[model samples]
Target: MKIAIHQMNSGIDPAVNRAAMDIAIRSASNQGAHFYFAPEMSLLLDRNRERGRIHIQHESTNRHIAALCDTAREAHIWVHVGSVPVLSEDGSGRFANRTLLIDPAGQIVARYDKMHLFDVDLATGESWRESNAYAGGTHPVLAQSPLGPLGLTICYDMRFPDLYSRLAKAGARAFAMPAAFTVPTGKAHWHVLLRARAIESAAFVIAAAQSGGHEDGRETYGHSLVIDPWGEILLDMGDGEGLGFVEINLSRVDEVRAQVPVHLNRRVIPPLD
Candidate 1:
């Protein structure tokens, strides 16, 4: 399938971010892509909680999401909206970093809340407490796409192999990992971890990432990548803000699995002695 990945340097305004997404989706469809993928926080990337709260509303009332669905319908392309912050349905006054998969007909096919929250203090003094504002999702999501079953995950979720294993066992052939990675971590672990995930699952890994400096005073490492089942880099949009396209052969999943047979041979091990 032909896919378009939109690498972005999103700012603090929700309206501006929504407009960028609209253009990218329409352009992707016009360029003959069947599916369009975007980075995390595609709609809003504001770090100011006070300001962000003004725009973060319940999914039912989020006008930006509604506009995106219409864009997908008008463009006639499937959309993997990396992740957006939405008010949690539970009245905890917290938000959920959610991924929405929209079909060509503009219907939501699946929704995945980011299960693993990022809470860390880096040596670079980049401390992030995701759980402070957002709640974690309880389940992993597997949704059917034109390319096959697609596994949905957000930024920090990439570090957990167990999630990918579960998705693969459940018949996911490709994984969408949308991220807004800090420069330090991205420089050290991004490519390696993504390649590892693809190799271990023997599945395709499509990662569209936020790049460069942002209006919120944060800089991100931008290399958006598309890795095949064998861990081959198909397309790498290096540290820039734009769209990257790639065509993937679904049959490669079976080819690699047949050669290695890791999926079939996997065993349920007892608690490590």
Candidate 2:
């Protein structure tokens, strides 16, 4: 299947980001891509909670998201919106880093809230407390796509293999790991971790990432990658912001699984007795 990945350097403005996505979606559809993938926080990437709160709205009322859905419908292409920050239904006043999968008909088919929040104090003197502003989701999300069943995850959730394993075992042959990674950690762990996830799960890993510096004065590692079940890199958009297209073979999932059979061999390990 041909898929388009958008590597973005999103800013604090949701409208601006939506415009970028609109153009990319049309371009991808024109190029005959079956799906268009975008990075996490594709709508807005503001660190200033006070300043960003105004743009963050309930999904029902978020104009930017609605616009993207309309664009997806017009383009007649499936869209994997890596993620967006939206008001949670829990009434906790915190947002959810949510991923929305829009079908070719422009209807939302699946939604996955990021399960793991990034709350780290990096050695680079950059500190992040995602849990402070966003509530983590409790369940794994697996959605059906033209490419097959896809496991949905965002950013920090990629660090937790159990989530991937659960989805893979539940019949997911592809994974979407959208991220806006800090430069330091991204440099150190990005490629290796993604490759590991693909190899272990024996599934395709499509990671659309935020790249370069942002309006919030933060820099992101932009090496968006598409890895095969054999841990081979198919396409790597290195630190550039734009659209990239690649064709993925669904048969490769079966080919790799037949050879290694990790799913068949997997056994639950009990905690220390």
Candidate 3:
């Protein structure tokens, strides 16, 4: 299926981001794309926790999500609202970095919360304590789609191999890794880790990324990538805010798995002291 990946530099405004998404969805649909995708925090990218909290909406009433759903129905195309910040499930005032998959009918087919939070102290003197404002998800989800069984993850989840391995073993043929990766880590590990995930799982890896500087003083390394099962980088939207399109061939998944037999080559290891 044809997929459109959007690389954006979103800020604190949901309206602005949704407007950008609207244009991308229509243009992508015109390009014969069956699905449209965006990066994590496509609606909000502020560093201020309280401001984000004030602006974030509950899942039932998020205007950004409503707009995207409407666009999906109108365009008759599927969309992965890469992810949006929402009120935490426990009513703790924190938020959930959640991804939603919408069908052409504008119905939400699946939702996955980001399992890993970006709590790190970068060598570049940049620090983040994502857990302060967001709660991590407890479960991994694989959503069924026309293309294949798609494994959903957001941002920091890409750094964990076990998550992807579990999903692939559960019959996922493709993985979506929507991210607003910080500049330092993105430059050091983004491509390598994504390629490794695709190679290890023998599945397609589609990562929609946020690019450039934001009003919150955060800079994301934008290189929205689409890697084939063979670990070939099919498309890379190199450090720019724009829309990228690629038609993924599902047959390649079977072809590569047959060749690699990744799931069958398992050897259990014991915990070390």
Q: Residues 1-273, candidate 3, lDDT per residue (tens digit)?
A: 888999999988888888999999999999999999999999888998777777887898887788899999999999998899888778787789999999999999999989888888888999889898788999999999987899999989988999998999889999999999888898899999999999999999999999999988889999999999999999999987999889899899889988988788877779998
Give per-residue CA lDDT, model 1, range 55-130, as digits (tens): 9999989999999999999999999999999999988999999999999999999999999999999999888999
Task: Tell me the tens digit of each residue's lDDT in model 2 across 1-273.
Answer: 899999999999999999999999999999999999999999999999999999999999998889888999999999999999999999999999999999989899999999999999988788999999899998999999998999999999989998998999899999999999999999899999999999999999999999998999999999999999999999999987999999999999999999999999999999998
CA lDDT, candidate 2, residue 166: 94
Q: List the residue pairs that clash in candidate 3.
A: none
Alpha-carbon TM-score of each model against the true structure: 0.99, 0.99, 0.97
Give the whole-model CA lDDT for all candidates, comma-separated.
0.95, 0.95, 0.91
Local error of candidate 2 at residue 83 (angstroms): 0.4
Model 1's alpha-carbon lDDT is 0.95
Off by over 4 Å in 1: none
Measured on C-alpha atoms, candidate 2 has an lDDT of 0.95
Model 2, total clashes: 0
